[model samples]
Target: MAGYATRVKADIARWREAGLIDPATAEALTRDVAANERASLSFGSILAMMAALLFGAAILIFVAANWEAIPRLARVVALFAVIAAGYVGGAVMKTRDHAAIGEALWIVAAAAFGGSIALIGQIYHLSGDEASALVTWCAGAALAAVALRSNPLTVAAVGIADAWLFLKGFDFFGRAEFLHFFIVMAIVLFAVSFWTRSQASRHLIILSVLFYLVLLVGDYDTLRIAVPLLIGSALLFAAAVFAGDPIDRILQLGGRLPLHALLGFLTGIAMIQFELADESTYASGFAVASIVALSGIVAAIMLAGRESRGLRWLAYAGFAFELAIIYSVTLQSMLDTAGFFLAAALLLGILALVIIRVEKRMRAAAHTGAAA
Candidate 1:
């Protein structure tokens, strides 16, 4: 028995020396491990669980009891009481290492309940404008998340607040100024996410960028210099694809599809203008071919990369735009138009077959690698 005890002690000593445990913590852990091996439950863990249950029940009872006549002061007091109870329960659970009962979950639930109570008060005639009421509710939620270190709820509150601001601003002013306000708000959210490490906030930023891109494209006809504007927009999309990660790649690629369609429409306009300006037929043909060739090359490169599904759609869009250009340049003569359509159909069919073959080979390689 003495020899067995000495061996166990030596093993523990080595663990401490290896920095797997701090000396003080190791002593406590060793005692806990021994107790656990004997199938014991710690008092602190039981107490923390009981506290959480009690507080949760208290919140329910308080709301139910005062559902009709809950005074403003009482609501505020209840909110603070819930927040304090949550912190204490969290601290107790942390000390006992009862991580299964998540602190963040309790905190967020409590905050949501408190916010609902406050919102109810507002609905019943506790004074505030729609903006102020929304801001207050979101602010309370944000505070709870920060206090409890809950990233998910913090992000949710941020998103709600941003949407509220955008809607209110648009309703008051109009769509024209809302675009600028949304961009500013998106930048602020992105900055906040960097510090908070909130994935939800990052997603909201992506959505904001997409919304702005759509707004810009819808208003493209307002621009006086259409060709230069189209080129700049295309360049911005290309830059976004190169500079952004996968998510940005998807957004930019989708945004660029509509731009391509717009390009085809604009191409018809340019043709009419050039014809009126007395441009030579050769010069016009060269210009049209150059635009089609450039767009097709870009699309092919994007499709080959296969980083996004949107890129594939954009590739198809480019092909459609190119066909439209070909039709316009040849529409004056029927035989030439038919020939151009036939050539395009053949090219698309071949491209589709090549893509399928490449995808099949990739799948086979992946399976082989996994098996190995």
Candidate 2:
């Protein structure tokens, strides 16, 4: 708040000078600036959180120390007591408007629920699928997150739930391990993202969806994993590229899927590695490999790297690596190495020239439109 105060004040003064908003409206908006002055957590709140976490850990240690001496019923009572105390403390803090403490307590309660699940499962000698315990634990945490509107709890729940679903995806190869459950979790994560408007939750949900797409290859032959992933990423990239009123008018879905840009960018890089790693052969194996490498580099540079510098550099690296592989494997003469570098330099020069021309045309068009 202190850092941004001058800029905030300047912006408010500009708005006032421009007569974009009334004085009362400006004051109304600046109320949040006043709140920001107190946004830093006080020492007492920070100390309280640390002590609470240490105390919880101490109780867990005590449980392990006296596991045999404590009766089974007493052990259960103690576990539930910890949960009850956390929630009660959180509620009290919430009522008193010390939301930092309340949020921390909610996180503690949610974490303790995981321990309770494991302990209860062990105590009852639960014989059915071990996945049920994880799923149940996830559901409990998600319920708490939704009910309390806690962003941290929501993110934790999504992560834990995805872990459980991923385990299932690996454990069961048949239709039983289909990604439907992960899909459901993605939907739930999206709802939580919208409800809480947390950017972290949205990113987590997108990562889950990306991972789910990767998981789809578990059932396929090991040789062809990249095909579907690249296709899916291309679809996402296309959707993001063509977003807005036209697509919405046709599909009745509003707004862009901004996450697609990042997901597609990363998937493009992954596809390059997988395509290079594949040792499979075809009729024209060398030609096929060359085309795949070239296409991957071009696609990444032109589309995926349009917004991300990392992806652009990764594409350049991939192109150089492809040349190294070709030189080391197919043509291993000093002359061949020299030729490879020359060819690479020429290719890059051509690409740069094309891009420069395109940028110049775009700028000229922008100027023309402004004049019109």
Top lDDT prediction, candidate number: 2
Worst 10 residues of 2 by lDDT: 250-259
Counting clashing residue pairs in each candidate, in order, gives: 0, 0
Q: Which pairs of residues have clashing backbones in candidate 2? A: none
Candidate number achieving the greatest TM-score relative to the actual structure: 2
How would you encode candidate 2's per-residue C-alpha lDDT over 193-232 as one tens digit per residue?
A: 5565455676677767777667765666533655555566
The TM-scores of all predictions, comma-separated, are 0.45, 0.69
Task: Write model 1 residue lDDT over 154-193, tens digit each, in one string.
Answer: 6756666666655655565343433455566556555556
